[model samples]
Target: MKQETHTVKKEFIALMAILMSLVALTIDAMLPALSQIGTSLQVADSNDSQLIITSVFLGMAMGLIFYGPLSDAYGRKKIIYLGIGIFILGNLLSIFSNSFPVMLAGRVLQGFGVASCRVVSLAMIRDQFAGPQMGKVMSLIMMFFIMVPALAPSVGQGILLFSHWRAIFVLVLVFGLICFFWLHFRQAETLVPEKRIPLSLASLKAGAAETLKHPVSRSYMLASGITFGAFLGYLSSAQQILQHQYQLGELFSLYFGALALAIGLSSFANSRLVMHFDMAKLCHWALIVITVTALAFYCYVEVLAEQPSLTALMAYLAVTFFSVGILFGNLNTLALHPLGHIAGIATSVISSVQTFISVLIGGIIGQLYDASVVPLVLGFFFCSLSTLILIYRTRKTSAI
Candidate 1:
């Protein structure tokens, strides 16, 4: 029984990781194609191309607000299938789009649909695990999830070399189809009928209110928003910064992949280490590390007015991303820790709030890109500092 259980758990983690990776694959794979899509669509401002990324986030933020409660009322599996269908539709729409507005709309739709996979998967995991154990599983899941980003840009670039940018969407659609069928055949409905909540507006409002009333969860959610905003800023600007600023061109994917590998390695390490440390403490320290690193990088570029060599930039990014990897699983586990009973609605509300806030901060930072790394680094510094402050305040309040 123990051996069987262990095998089952491993399979579950892998499936969940693939589900989550769909989001990363969707976003990161589009990075290398942004300029091509922009040119083909005749975007007025070059910076506006970043909208291709943020639009999905916006749609996701909106879609997540509802998927949680609906999933809670229905069941995790059905909502997931529904989300997959919507995601496929969005991909098809994007593939057929000839204008920027249509493409943006399709991206938003894709994001909105993908929210089900993200929210439901987190909820499903929370259903089966909790505490440091939950952190361990999430770390393992993220270990696989991070691999998507590590290779997605390279995959996108390779596709662009041989085919039109639309091929990327086709790839996403094919990937989603595989996930859907695998999920259908292999995964069982984790939410029991007796445990399911009723689908109602009042219930959703109450759930949201309950989620907000928890000081720890609320604080962690806000911190997550701020931290993710910094990450999003990096994602939105990374292609331009690498290709234009460093003149890496096609080599941009290699550099981006290297940074992504740092995050994957750190997540793998965190999976092994989380069992020995408190998730909150790990997150607190990781935030501090990122804060200091970001501040140093900002100073190097701003006050010192020195352009860091490619080696120095990559080193700084690797450290920051490693800390970020540690924070991702831990912070999420912390936010969802207190609300496990209402995991579906809780995950939705928490994720939606965090994503919404992140989109605002991240969109502004991305738009502020001035062919320099100053805004990106400064965004990271301030966001991490704010997150650290929130963690401190939450800890103090919790002790009382």
Candidate 2:
């Protein structure tokens, strides 16, 4: 019985990681193909290629607002199935799209479909764990989730060696199908019927109001969005900065993977560290570190009057993303910790606000790319600094 319990726990963690990872896989795996996609779709501005990334985020932001309330009324498993089905359909749409606008629409649909996984998985985690233990589990899940970003660009690049960019969507489709079945067969529904909230306009209004009213939940959700917006800026511009600005050529994937590995390793460390320290303290310090790192790098680049060397840029990214890794799990856990009773609705509201803010902030930063890293670095500094102020203002509140 003990062994069975252990097996279930391990499988549960792995499954949650994969479900959350679908978003990362969808975004990062397409980084390598962005240029090709833009060229094929005949985009007038090269920078417009970044929309392929942010459009999905825009979809996610829109979807999260709806998925949460529905998941609460329905069940997690049903929502997961629905999300995967929509994801597959979106992939097919993208595969056949001939115009940039149509392709973006497809990506938006993909984002909307996968938003279910993000809301449901986090709600499920809330169903099973709480407090620092919940933070620890989130960190562990993140450690695995981060791996997708580490390898996705490389996978996308490898696929391009022999096939067109559309083939990449096909690969994503297959992976989505596999994850769909994995959940269907291996995971039991975490939200029970008795605890299910009825879906209604009034109920959603109450849940949204409740989530917004909780000082810790509201502040942490905002802080999460503010901080992650910087990272999202990095994601939206990574291909342009690394491949076009730095001229890494085919080696872009290696550098990208190395930086992703930094985040993954930090998440692994956070999983253990959460057991020893307050999750809030970890997030507080992480915000400081990234804020300072971004400021320093911006100053160095400004003084040089040129883009920093690849070595300097990588060093800065490694540190900033390491800080980002610590913040991701801790911030989300803090926001959700006080709202577990309404996990589904709460996760939706938090995620929707967080993702919408990120997309708007990140999309602006990406559009500012001008063969220099100045805009991206400044974006990081401002976003991190803003989060630091937000987190400090809410320090008196109990994170537990």
TM-score winner: 2
Please write out the lDDT profile of model 2 over residues 5-46, one tens digit for every residue: 989999999999999999999999999899999999999899
Task: For each candidate, give its TM-score against the true structure.
Answer: 0.98, 0.99
CA RMSD of all predictions: 1.2, 0.8
State the lDDT of candidate 1 residue by residue for 340-359, as single tens digits: 98899999999999999999
Off by over 4 Å in 1: none
**What C-alpha lDDT does candidate 2 achieve relative to the native structure?**
0.92
TM-score of candidate 1 relative to the true fold: 0.98
Model 1, position 17: C-alpha lDDT score: 97
The models' CA-based lDDT, in order, is: 0.92, 0.92
lDDT score for residue 284 of model 1: 83
